[model samples]
Target chain A: MTAMSSAGHSRERHALLLMLSVLAVLAILHIQQGARPIPATVMLDAVLSPDRDAFDHFVILSLRLPRASACIVGGAAFGAAGFLLQVAMRNRLAEPHVLGLNAGASLAVVLVTTYQPVVLPDILMPFAASLGAAGLFGLVLALSALGSGRFDPVRMVFFGIALSALASALVSAILILNEDTLEQLRFWLVGDAAGGGAAAVWSILPAVALGLVAGCLLMPQLATFSLGESISVALGASVHRTRIAALVVTALLCGSAVSLVGPIGFVGLMAPALWPRLHQRPSLGAFLLVAGSGAAILLAADILALGLLAPTELPTGALTGLAGAPVFIWLVARRLT
Target chain B: MTSRSADPPTRSRLTAEALSVGHGGQAVVQDIELDIFEGCMTALLGPNGSGKSTLLAGFARLLPALGGSVRLDGSDLATFPTRHVARVLGLLPQQPPVPEGLSVFDLVARGRFPHQGFFSQWSRQDEAAVGEALALAALADLADRPVETLSGGQRQRAWIAMVLAQETPLLLLDEPTTFLDAAHQVAILDLLRDLVRRHRRTVVCVLHDLNMALQYADRLVFLKEGRIRHVLTHPSQCDGRIIEEVFEMPVVSLKHPQSGLPVFLPCASRQPEARP
Candidate 1:
């Protein structure tokens, strides 16, 4: 037992090291690959200690650093959010985008942007998104309880899908009627970190940090939850408490991510999918690895979005959707069937 | 049929008095009065829709009783916190869904949830309990195997091992032997019997196979139309008339060739005489 556990420990350690290395490489590439590329030496020097006068230092500090931070922060939040949602709902397909959380957040942002009597600053946007996500989640919860008093996993997912459709339609209608708002939101709506990069990161940090801490604290309880409700209840766990806590964490994390990056689709889905085996045997370390995977995938995708188009930046949301659609299909085919 | 006192001894570990449990708004099992004794394997036997599972659910506190009360050791079960109740009793629902890629050991380790707190997640006591449960379920060799990959009987045993790790003296199982072949059924039954005899655990299991229940169970509670029809201490006391009346089918009692215990066998319905 000692030998086997030690071996397992080392394997997890190695995997963590590899993931960190990948994230590091991606972060560096993210900082270097924008419009007018900075050389590697300049990038390193800028990161180590910026010279106030150097144009390269200014570009790295002002432009790329915040963009990169957005990707890592948003990705990690989505990853942890997705993992917690799946555990709470006990469904593999339970992710922010699929469960209407992203659309809900988007709808909130659109509503505030279009109809707020005064033009609020970009920093206050995530709060609206967080409120929307939580509100929609309550609706989903109430609808899931329509038939059985118990929260059925499949029923909740179906309701989320329905709510997602409704929210999307409303958003499209609002955008079409208001063309001025449409042009203003044209780029931001598709999930780009270029415009309010630094401000977005700072705005969403506290909520995301709170959500992640809550997720970590609820890890042991969530592990029991994966065993299904009856068994979880039988084992003396208050399933209701765990479920509510998990959903709240998911809402905070996902709402903050959506507000930051304009609902970058599929990071949540891909995060859990990346650590399929780890989810089966949930541990705090495994959960962190999943969150890390989400961070890495998003950072890499954002870099690809920037690098692939050079001066013409593709929306990170579009790139993630392109990558994540197939995974969503695969999970449905494999898990649902 | 032999008639006796409806109220058993006061020392019963788990008891249900006037318990009416159901789904939605309607009661499926109504006015159930039964006592689960200590250190005895009690099998609930009945036909389909006889409320066997419902009664078990009531006892396990998985479903709320519509009218009456379920008691654990003389106290109303609803008064105690769920976690405290869990430490005293363990329940295995019928075919609980197994998480993908869950190992037998991890599955058993979950049974230790009631014992551990937030900071004291995985202790030496937890490990020892899991190891002991794996051994007790005869699943030590297959501990590392994912439950999805195990054979039906082995998977069932692994689930049992999970409940065993709870270290509860009373166990409530809803159809533990379902989906198993005859040999595996006997093996599972023997395991339950050993639990009662060797570990002194009180077990209440819902069984469909009358012969198997007759062969293994120390006590049998027969149900019909949401009511306890009869309760017998020994298979020798059970007769075909009660089975025929409750199930509404003809049956014959045959003595086993080796053990000479009476086994109830369903017989063909008697045909009506010709009009002539």
Candidate 2:
């Protein structure tokens, strides 16, 4: 047993290192391989000391840097959130997009941007996003609860899909009512990472940090949650409290991600799903690996979005959604078989 | 009522007062007044729908009582925080949903969750308890095997190993041997006997088999229609009549040849001499 466990431990270490290395390489590609490609020396110099006159420096600072960083950080947050949602709900299919968290954040942004006469500042988007995500999550919980506090996986999945459709309808209704903001809402709704430069991301940093802290706090609880509710409670876990805390962390992360690049799909689902292939158990280590791999996937997707179309950018969310749906379908198919 | 009874000289009791345990607002088992003595093996036996599992769940605080309270070692069960309650009592529900690809060792180690803080490092105590539990369950040989891959008997043992890893004084099991074959059932019952007799751990489990309970349990709580018919210290205290009443079947009570303990054997419901 000792020998076998030691072997598994070493395998996990190797996988972790490989994941981190991939993340680093993807991040570099994201920063250096945009349509206006900046040389490494120029990018480094711009990062270390700003030369306001240099065009490459301007592009690096004002465009690609934050976009790349947003891909990494927001992707990591989404990965953590998705992992928590899957464990808390005890359903492998559960993710922020499937659970309507991303849609909720988007709807909140739509509501704020369209309904309010005064344009909401970019700084407050994360707050509205978090509020929307948490509210939708509460509704999802209530809908699935069905008079019982128990989170039945099958019921929750149905509720998530229904809730997402309802949110989309509301978003469409607002867009129709206010036709003037149509073009701007289309970019945000499609989930663009281009203009999410430093100031915009920085404004949401507090929310991201808050979400990360929540994820860390909930990791231990979530790790034990796979033991099933009875066993979890037997091990002295307050099942309901652990559940609420997990949902809160997930909402915060999803909200933060939405605030950064609108709702990019599948980064959450694809990231953690990779760990099981590496034989990762549901633990803090697995959560970190999922977060790293999540960052990698989104960054790779962002690179494709930028480099693929040159001057005309593909929305990051569109790229992820197009690819994510197939993988999600495959996962469901495999599980059913 | 305060006496701890014949329980390895240790003092820990799970006592219930007019406990009405149920799901939603409906009580499945009502007015369950009982005391589970420390370090003893108590088996709850009853017919289907008699509420053995529900009563155990209520005692574990998974199901709220409609009216009345359960006290854990003199502390109101409701007042004890989740982790605090976990530090003392461990429960194993029937056929719990197992995570896919979880190894036996990892599953057992998770039993230490209650003792672990939100940020607690994996401690030597936790590691040792897991090792000890694996050894006790005889699953040390199959520690690396995923629980889903294990056979029915091995899987049952793996679940027991997890409960053992909790290292609590009291364990509550809901039909621990319900689905196992006859041989496997005896094996699990023997394991529970070892738990109580050797480790000084208290066990309260629901069992459908009367013979298995007779052989293993220190005491039996025979329930019928949501109420206990008898709490017997010895099998001799029960006769064929009580078995017939509870199970709704006729049986013959005879002495075990070796131990001289009473053993109930099923017999024809009608007197054999009657014409066909």
For B7-104, candidate 1 gives per-residue lDDT tens digits of 34335989899999998869999888888988877899998999999899888888988988999999999999999999999999998886677778
TM-score of each: 0.91, 0.93
Per-residue alpha-carbon lDDT of candidate 2 for residues B1-276, written as tens digits (9 for 90 to 100): 112244343554888899998877988898888889877889999899999999999989998878889999887899988888888888999998766778888888888888888666577788888899999888888998988899988998999888888999889999989889999998898888888777878899999889878777778898887887888875557788888999998789887776566788888556568678
Q: Tens-digit lDDT track for model 2 on A35-123?
A: 66577888789989999998998888888888888888888888888887877877778888987898899888788877775667777
Q: lDDT of all the models against the reference?
A: 0.84, 0.82
Clashes of 2: 0
Off by over 4 Å in 1: A2-11, A114-125, A140-162, A172-184, A335-337, B1-10, B257-260, B268-276
The best candidate in terms of lDDT: 1
Per-model chain A TM: 0.92, 0.91
lDDT value for model 1: 0.84
- lDDT of each residue in A72-129, candidate 1, tens digit only: 9889998988888888877777878877798889899889888996676766667678
Can you list each candidate's DockQ? Answer: 0.55, 0.56
